[model samples]
Target: MTLNILSRQNTVLNKFIAQIRDREIQRDPMRFRRNMERIGEIAAYEISKTLRYTPRIVETPLGQAEVAQIDDSIVLATILRAGLPFHQGFLNYFDDAQNAFVSAYRKSTKDGKFKVKVEYISCGDLEGKTLLLVDPMLATGSSLVLAYEALCERGGTPAHTHVASVIASEQGIDYVTNHMPHQTTTIWAAAVDEELTSRCYIVPGIGDAGDLAYGEKI
Candidate 1:
């Protein structure tokens, strides 16, 4: 699997990423959510470049013009709650793309460990389509892998999967690289952190994206 780190290059995307990571700025839920959405929009633009395109002729007011238009079928699948705003950013660009939602969370198990449980999934036919799995934070990666499996189980396997995250941990990236369909999956992240907490939170990472975007859960 190929990994694309957008922050590696300096751009406006880095500004949004910084705002999300700033504790003081995070106090504003609206701004936090908007920043995540902005990051998603940028990611969508970058991912669009890799999609297949075909030449099409269009009639203009004056004459006819030929343009290269996207030809690949796309499905935008996002993990619930935290992914909603991020998903919207992609939707703004790929306005006609199909969408899928999966409800997956970390359920506490014995000791300090937790297992990812997928409670519900809503999707349509995914056969031979390009899948964009959007999640704001990728700390453990288990939830993502489980979500992908659940999606495929219900919607059939997609031709290619693009794993999109706002921030990803090194371990999470490694896990995804090992577990996902290597040849067909590509990972994209705005930033990559090197540490993960014992509870599976990325260090120096924006704390609880879901909570910051919305509110804290009980």
Candidate 2:
């Protein structure tokens, strides 16, 4: 089944594209990761603007004024290893929100094809909460689904879920639309690329996200 894909377009998102595409820019792991984080920061701000708020009075140096405050409790969940930096961006804005982390790996068999496996998960209660699931790359989306399922099993189903990604492939978007629980899920991607390589990497994607953010693993 096809679903609505929300493309986050803005000057900051364009900047993310420039950095992710430049060969030299990607060489510096630190900067590359920070760029991803910055993208998250910008997206977070945009998303927050649309959230529900209530009037609250605060005492200032001069006077007290009523202001609307975000009413929904937030839970930031990141698919680990690669998602750390991206997650950091969300955390920067959601400093007071509860945090959850999940580790997933793509397991391959003899045929060279693979499946996602959820290895580690840590989360708090999520019932009636708003959750933001951050993952750097949305390639095949199998891992994203697995991570979501793992979190739900551990932390109860959230009232709403926002899947955030730096780059997404069409196939990956399709996969998530088909596999994820659609009633409460909405996808927000910085950019959408048209390619999915034979090995499941988004073409022109900033290579291995974990490698770019962290380093090559043995």
Candidate 3:
């Protein structure tokens, strides 16, 4: 899979990322959510460059103009709750794109390990379309891979898949590399961290994106 790390180049995106990781700034749930949205918008812009485009003529009051229009059919899918705002960012750009939502969470097992459970998925036909799976955090990558499998099982396989994450662990990236289709899949992250805790949380990562954006769960 092709990996694109946006932080590799210096840009204003880095400021938003730094704020999200800051404890003081995280105190403002509104700011945290907005920053996430900003990051998503930036990612959407970058991802757009990889899509196919075709030239089209447009009618104007003065005369006629030709513009390049996107030709690929896009489907934007997100893991619920945390991905809501991030998905909105992509939607802000690909407003006409189809949308899919999946509800997946980590379920604790008796062995103390956890398994990803995909309880619900709402998607339309994905055959031959480009699928963008946006998730805010990628720690272990199990949820993302399982979400992709569940989506394909229900909506049919997409022509191409773009996985977007705000923060990803190195191990999680490796896991996705091995699990997802190498040739057809691309991974995009705003930043990548080196460590993951035993419970599968990225070190120096923005803690509990869902909780920070919304509220703490019981």
Give stretches of model 2 more than 4 Å off. 1-10
1-218: candidate 2 lDDT, tens digit per residue: 32323344436468776897688899998888888888889768866876679999999999999989999899999988999999999999988999999988988989999888898998999998999998979998989988988999999999888888888898888888888877888888887889998899999877898887777998
Off by over 4 Å in 1: none
Per-model lDDT: 0.94, 0.85, 0.95
Every model: Cα RMSD to truth: 0.8, 1.9, 0.7
Better of 2 and 3 by lDDT: 3
Assess every candidate by TM-score.
Answer: 0.98, 0.94, 0.98
lDDT of 3 at 92: 94
Among these predictions, the greatest lDDT belongs to 3
Off by over 4 Å in 3: none
Sort the candidates on lDDT, descending order: 3, 1, 2
* True-vs-predicted CA distance for residue 34, candidate 3, Å: 0.6
**Root-mean-square deviation of candidate 3:** 0.7
